[model samples]
Target: MAEVQQNTGGDGKKGQQKKMQIRVDFTPMVDMNMLLITFFMLCTTMIKSQTLTIALPSNEKVDNVENMSQASEDDAVTIILDAKRKAGSMEVDTVNGKVVPVVYYYFGKPGGPEGLGDAPETIAARNNLQESEFLGNDEKSGKARGIREIIQQRNKDVLTEINKLKEKYASGGFGSLETKEGREKAQLAYDEAASKVRKDENLKKPVIIIKSTPQASFGSLVSVLDEMQINSISKYQIDNMTKADSVMVIDYQNRHHK
Candidate 1:
């Protein structure tokens, strides 16, 4: 509510004009603001923070030989992350103020059936470590390149089944994707089918092992894990780098970079 008061000076001259004053009462407005704040606080829904779930390695050390034997060497894929080295130096290299990431991968046991031996000559000779980049995909063809291509190739079987399930869902095989309720039900069914495909014992799937050098950036590690999810890889774990892995990487760098 607002009030106006007109004041006329008692002994003023005849030509003197009256003055008016205005005063506004804001108590109601303050109360209304408090009510609005309370209403919003009670009715508004808070967004839950999202996080990615990743499987971390066990604290207890396990023998690599026994681990490899459990899952066939053919199905094992080891991806190593390293910081790019400067020319003719062991220092980390950066591009445009960012550390350049280098990817190295080896299939099966390190150094094949014989394993990585103590001798430097033997390590150099048996080094199966291959270098790759984090190049995501080709823009025109939408084809995966670099490390992504290797992972997709190994997980093609599961992906094939998943793709089929997608086709069925899109064609209303699961249910009608038209209505809201229908879309929800169809999505649930699609998820269940995809889960079955991933867990099917008959499907041939690769077990990926991720390792990183001391100098590798956290962003690079996250990128590799993103690839695992993008490729629909179910069996993947973060593992510590071994001495043999160090030797092989060193030998490979020495041979090629020199």
Candidate 2:
């Protein structure tokens, strides 16, 4: 509420009209503005940070064979993550204000059948390590690019159904995408669809085993995990780098660095 006051000044000149000035009280307005600010500050929602929830295995070894998840060599894809190294040195390399992540992957075991076998002669032939990098979706096609593309290619059998689900989601098959409540419903529906595809035994999906070097950035690790999620891979897990995994990464970097 506001109040107005009228003031009259008089020189009292003959036949001259008197002037009136109106003043508006601003104290109420100032108080109202403060209250509005406080109310908005209290009512506004803050964004929450997202996280990946991983289930860790127990320390004790499982005695039951049925409890362990086993994979055949044909269905296994091993992804090794490392920080790009300087030529002729083990030093980490950076590019464009970011730590460069080097990715090497292989189907089946490290060093192939011989398993990083006895010596250098066999190691060279069987190393089986191929390099790649984490890349975002293509600007034009909107399809995933880089390492993501490679993984998706291997898991296309599952992606065929997942892509359909994506199309359904975009078309509002789950719910209206325009509103907040609708988006939530759509996401739940999408998750359910993808989950069904992942668990479908009839569909063939690659089991990705992710191993990272100590020198790699946490961001790179997260980026790789994002690929797994984006690809709808249900069988991937974070695993420790074995001696062979470490050796293969070193050999790949050394040979390629030159």
* Candidate that scores best on lDDT: 1
**Any runs in candidate 2 off by more than 4 Å, and if so which?**
1-46, 61-72, 170-189
lDDT of 2 at 102: 81
Cα lDDT of model 1 by residue, 97-180, tens digit: 899999999988889779888887888888899999999999999999999999989999999998899999999999998999
Q: Which 10-residue span in candidate 1 carries the lowest summed lDDT?
A: 63-72
* lDDT of predicted model 1: 0.88
TM-score of every prediction relative to native: 0.77, 0.76
- Global lDDT scores for all candidate models: 0.88, 0.82
- Window of ten residues with lowest summed lDDT in model 2: 63-72
TM-score attained by model 2: 0.76
TM-score of 1: 0.77
C-alpha lDDT of candidate 2 relative to the true structure? 0.82
